[model samples]
Target: MGSPAERYTYPSPLAGFENAPPLPDEKNEDGKSFKNPPRDILSEAYTTFPEPLENGRRGAFDVHIYYFSSNKAYAKELWERIRREFPELRIYRFWDHPVGPHPVAMFEVNIFTPAQFGAFIPWLAIYRGPLSVLIHPNTVEGGEGVSHMDVERRNHSQRAIWMGERIPLDLDLFYAMGS
Candidate 1:
């Protein structure tokens, strides 16, 4: 069996597809194979939410991540993986059922912190999700706009400035980022 990391590589067609296997050249009708793939998982939860939140004495810092993906399965997969790895992070869903909308799917996912937001990065990239983060380094005393920052697509990694003041925010900003 593949490990959790392996599961992130890529998913394949499961049994019981909408149409039978096709010949190399057969183009039936819908113009795509899984043109409306079935929904797999529609819900999620963190292993450490609600509790730590209620206990209060928040983490040193946190951030908000705003994103939209064109692929539903990919978004869902990323969401699940993010939850499994960083249960302390909270996630809110807004575009699960509208992938086929006019301009394709415009999903909104909010991640509360690196403890939770970082894990979602891999999935979002694989699923083609837009990434706009409100970063707050745990120890950095200032946010006078970073100096050297750029978003990379080749290796699936990049750096962007937080572009804000030194004042920090709590779960609300982060919770809102992912939305």
Candidate 2:
């Protein structure tokens, strides 16, 4: 093996972009000035969500914090602290037993805006001692009188983001709904 420093040298994933071509600035190839400049459009803080999702629901995401029955006390303590800290968030009641698709006891927290998502998720990551957190986007295939339980299933299983141990969900709950 080479020296310790040289042995670990590997090209960065971004190295491919080093020689990438640059896009035209503000003006297009035709040289016609664009009405909305890139800088002007994003001057303010981007702390909002795409509200009223396709299904016309306000919450764009749901954060489920799960803990086993053995850790009920610790989980309850964390839930209380969350209530005190993030009063703005829609924190549902702490269930001591498994509820719906959740295979274990969990408390659901709905996130409305990007700001709440940015703030609360990281806080939970740091403070959720020995807890599993599931973050899933609410993706509804919008239409009139269309049952989208399949979409919901994909959201929970395929598109879900898990922090810490990934608890298996009882997917039968979705199927039982009978779309």
Candidate 3:
């Protein structure tokens, strides 16, 4: 094993793009670039999503609604309702086992815009029924390529916005990767 102070490194995925043009200079008065930059000539129109974090630090928040595999019937019904009701939102297929950072079988809903979030969360708050929901903002604090799952687990109860029964997550996967 390496020393605690030893650093780990991986090869660059964009090794050939060493001479790529530098990012455009900031246009804002503060000299900082925003995630959703001001509208430009190329793209004059776009949807404005609320920045989950201040200073445009993060993009969006992920809302995962978890249901036991055994409760597939009810979960399916609810999932369909969600689909029909929110056709414009991005919803993923339900997984029987833990996938991504989730510790239980769950279907994911990506809330890109704050308006969507405002509309959806209230409905979920009252209508989720028996399902447990895990909502976390997509922010990277430590470094790039670090999974939010690690940060979630560290502050599992505190960081996440949980709605129901909190299941134990297989956090080993995240720890192993960091090692």
Candidate 4:
């Protein structure tokens, strides 16, 4: 029998994806086969958002800007600046202490369209300073009458995107409320 390292030389478990089947060639209008090109994700991102993210009121995502007690001054200043700069966005009041699932003090911002997300996220990247941001999608996944808390828990834990340091969320609150 070969040694463990030698046995895994070519098709190693870690590199298994390298052996995946090639993407199918696209059929052009003239009935010719050509290599399917990758989509321009950045350019298309400004216009296309998933249909599930279409909430009637509060928009597609929640952006949480978290701060420690030490950096409260800077966080507060940033929050004020966001309010002044993006007057169209739904900006919530700043909380001085941890609220709901969040571990630290944070102010919430809701953005509706993909264009807004493309614009504001980059602007925030430059201006956010030492604060960590949590961006989670909001969706009505189960259609008409299912529990919304289940969806909230999934979005906060599974679908969340973090900028800078990621904080551990207090998911026990979700469990309590969901029950």
The candidate maximizing TM-score is: 4
Q: Give the winner by TM-score: 1 or 4.
A: 4
lDDT of 3: 0.67
Which residue pairs clash in candidate 3? none
The digit string of per-residue lDDT tens for model 2 on 65-105 reads 99887888888999899899989878899887888799888
Query: Could you tell me how far off, in angstroms, the CA of residue 107 lies in candidate 4 after the best superposition?
Result: 0.4
Q: In the order shown, what is each candidate's alpha-carbon RMSD?
A: 18.5, 12.4, 11.1, 10.4
TM-score (all chains, Cα) for each model: 0.26, 0.69, 0.60, 0.73
Q: Which stretches of candidate 3 lie over 4 Å from their true place?
A: 1-59, 140-158
lDDT (10s digit) by residue, model 4, range 1-179: 24534422222543534866687777877787676757645444458676467555878999999998899999999999999999878999989889999988999999988878888999999999999999999987675544688678778976799999999999778878978
1-179: candidate 1 lDDT, tens digit per residue: 24535423323444345575543654448766534433565323333333112223334233333334444454566667666765665454545332311122323334444335446555444543443444332222213432112101101111123322222223233224324
Give the worst 10-residue stretch by lDDT in candidate 1: 150-159
Query: Which consecutive 10 residues in model 3 have the weakest lDDT in total?
Result: 50-59
Candidates in order have lDDT scores of: 0.37, 0.75, 0.67, 0.83
- What is the TM-score (0 to 1) of candidate 2? 0.69
> Candidate 1 or 3, higher lDDT?
3
Worst 10 residues of 4 by lDDT: 7-16
Clashes by residue pair, model 2: none
Which regions of candidate 1 deviate over 4 angstroms? Answer: 1-56, 69-73, 92-130, 137-179
Model 3 TM: 0.60
